[model samples]
Target: MLKGHDFLITVKAPGKLYIAGEYAVVETGFPAILVALNQFVTVTVKESGDYGSIYSQQYRENSLLWKREGNHMVFDNRDNPFHYILSAIKLTETYAQEIGKKMKCYHLRIDSDLDSPDGKKYGLGSSAAVTVATVKALCHFYNLPMTKSRLFKLAAIAHLDIQGNGSLGDIAASVYGGWIAYNSFDRNWLKKARHRYSLTALIDRKWPQLNVELLTPPKELSLLIGWTGSPASTSHLVDAVGLKKAEQVKNYQKFLHDSRACLKRMIKGFQTKSLATIKEEIRRNRKLLQSLGVLSDVQIETPLLHALCETAEKFGGASKTSGAGGGDCGIVLINDSSNTQALLANWKEVGIEPLDLHVHRVND
Candidate 1:
């Protein structure tokens, strides 16, 4: 018989922002810079009466019941808002079973600050954060000694299972925290491996092919995040961009070459504390994105996004739409924070909400 009440465990993971090398990160498998924002998704697990239940404060779901079927965990409700959570629980439970451990029944409460006060997701990688947090909480609850790398791989697998695409850069930032320079692992290789081995089997072994490096931003640099009040579907945008690339293969390849070079310079700028180099790379990046938008006839950047960048530029800052960025959050990198108020005021006047976010770590 399992104990009805035992212990409570909570885990929090930070959201992420892709600072540079967005579209190309998926295609070229090059290094993409990502920062873990202070915004976090938190999961708390505690003992329950009978079966387990979940309450998602972010999604406003009162109570959701989940059960274990053989070696797998399954959500009792379909079309629920806890896709990531459900997937995470299933994976964690499976891992525990494979390692000859049993998990007790418990209630989990999930919440997030990645949304606005009114509950609008601000394009922060909330899904990835939630996945990481859930896995961490599960491991903690079951007394599993999962290393950070193993946790990352589990979270990445859950994330990939849902979205079916992505470079897992967001997952890396959430798992490792702080800032990271991530080179995309070969999706083809991962696909083949997944078919050949179980997730637990893969976690037991190390893959020399995975590449993730930490990068420190310049001390003089200030990063400001601004929400556009409009949401963009990253998958849709990525798919559209992919279609455009297929249509204009040669041009897209040339653009990728330039973007790759620009990202390298941007990385170097961070290391050397060269603000001018960073700004130039950012400018080239936006120009290339704009060129892609024009060629594909897609909405890469909105009018307000451009206006925010221009306003920031007036204050000796460089801004660009971060991530898939038709309308979501834009990143503003400032060398001089002397006039941050002015830049923020200009952005506010144009209906952009400047989010107060910064680099964050899991344990800090």
Candidate 2:
């Protein structure tokens, strides 16, 4: 039973990223920090007219066929949009039931600016972003509360609904917004715990949040981001690392322990503006990634990325790949702005595409 006329609603959701803390989070059960960028997905909800539907500009392009039964938005097709929207609606429904009210029904137009211009999955969490946006829109439409944790839970549902095994870090980053320290090994997430922490507390309380975040902003770096043009799987690399742990237990343990110490120091260095110490950490971290088998010899020395790193070195900066790097985007943290153009031109010489990322708060 429904009564009121249609109402339009819109909600914005940000993009996902990693600023500091990666695999460490999953292992040590610490928070992996990330910066949510301006890249976002917007969901437009329209009250059901004679007909109802949903469309995504950048993702879930198939305008889902729909039928509005009073206040219910019924699905006519199945896909990412179907499951994600339903998950949001379901949560809203639960809330409505608890409050003894009917949730609003509106046609949804969901879209994004994060899709690869070429329609490829760039290993970024585009779907996760969409899921978060959908959850936010539905929460707004139904006048349901939106807490970072509850929102993350919805996104996780959407993600798990689509791809069974989801990355909690990416979801947490998008839901919380801004820089986040995510370690999947964080006992909290593994234990299904959702305790939250702030970058202010994680970083030096003295570290300037605004300035530190600006480092990974949406600007295109003078560096190059290559796709490796191959869909390299992290599973195999991860397995190899795991297998080596028991076989060469002593060596691998030492490597991990050393790397963890280096990362801790690096986190401190980042706080103190100690670039000198930071450089040592990156060098040691890369070596440790090598030891853990996260980086392959072919990857680190690839002529394209290697050349790019070499070029950045000459310009007083460093470059490396992001994520579980069998093949993924490479990032260059260059200190020299004057040489960016030439550096980019040189990278273009090798067919690596430059990717721009907007960095900001991960949550409200």
Candidate 3:
């Protein structure tokens, strides 16, 4: 089964951009739509001597020597940048042991195209992508059968171990490429279930309310992305909103209801292949997020993001901040009849750099 002389195995997971339904998606059973971008985090595993090393191109201190102590990974240095990768390795290896697979030391290397040239994050869900890529690469190395569902569950478990908050929608998009309508599973349920069930039993069980459905965008619909050159911490923003959510319970409930209804209509737009309806709901979703920001006292839409949306509107494209959005990327939806060049020009004038990214399909 080992084809290469070096016994190398490589896997790449695509980064994701939220199309609609941001904050609300964090709640169990709430829905969000996202697309996997062409950019990716690639993980390569190769046979090593006795101990394994991890090298990442994105970090200044790139290499870390790790050895296995029973099931635990003992790192040479505690100052490490690979929390998500380490989590993935630990969880995947735990599952391997559950299924009677032999484990061996292997060198893992990571390369990412999800950030800017100078190592600035572009809000493309790099952590989720890297986690998925690491889990996928290790599964292959262990000769484990990895279905899409299994991959998503293992990756989600690994990511949630590090992140501790937010919907795992990014993991879904990374696992199942292209456009997807995702409903978050109940994290509370998983937290309790993990104590009751083993890793193998949990992977074999159905996660409550978690759903991932591939979506087909209308042929006439065109997507545009613009980077504001500022990266936001998703965990910090989510925590901020969570703190306010309890104080304004009525307002938070209203926001959730509105988001669910709006996303339903948008999903219908996709089902009917109506580009106009999809764009209309995108504008509506933007307004909802603005109200949410006002209620939560979080600046979800920065000035640069506001300018980005306004410029897109002037050019006949519906736009909004993509994710948690303290300052990151904004997404725009246009049609074949729209003026694409004018939009790019106006975006640049406002200091918004248009990114040349496309939807990445798994088969592609």
Candidate closest to the true structure, highest lDDT: 3
Candidate 1 weakest lDDT stretch, 10 residues: 1-10
Whole-model Cα lDDT of every candidate shown, in order:
0.81, 0.55, 0.91
| Model 2 misplacement above 4 A | 1-6, 49-52, 57-101, 160-167, 185-256, 294-307, 336-338
Write model 1 residue lDDT over 1-364, tens digit each, in one string: 0122349887788899988888888863677788998888888899766699988866874355576889998754322337878888998988888787866889999888987888666888888888898888888888876888899988888877776777788889998888787878777777788788877788766654567887777788888888899877676688788888889988888878988888898989888878888888888888988888887778888998888788888888878889988998889888754589988988899899999888886552
Cα displacement (angstroms), candidate 3, residue 304, comes to: 0.6
Model 3: per-residue Cα lDDT over 1-364, one tens digit each: 1133467998889999999999999999999999999999988999888999999868755556577999999764322338889999999999999999988999999899999998788999998999999999898889887889999999999999877898999999999999999999999999999999999889889999999999999999999999999988888789899999999999999999999999999999999999999999999999999999999999999999999999999888999999999999999999978889998998899899999999999762
Ranking of all candidate structures by their TM-score, best first: 3, 1, 2
Overall local distance difference test of candidate 3: 0.91
TM-score for each predicted model, relative to the true structure: 0.90, 0.70, 0.93
Residue 21 Cα positional deviation in candidate 3, in Å, after optimal superposition: 0.6
| Candidate 1 backbone clash number | 0
Query: Could you tally the backbone clashes for each prediction?
Result: 0, 30, 0
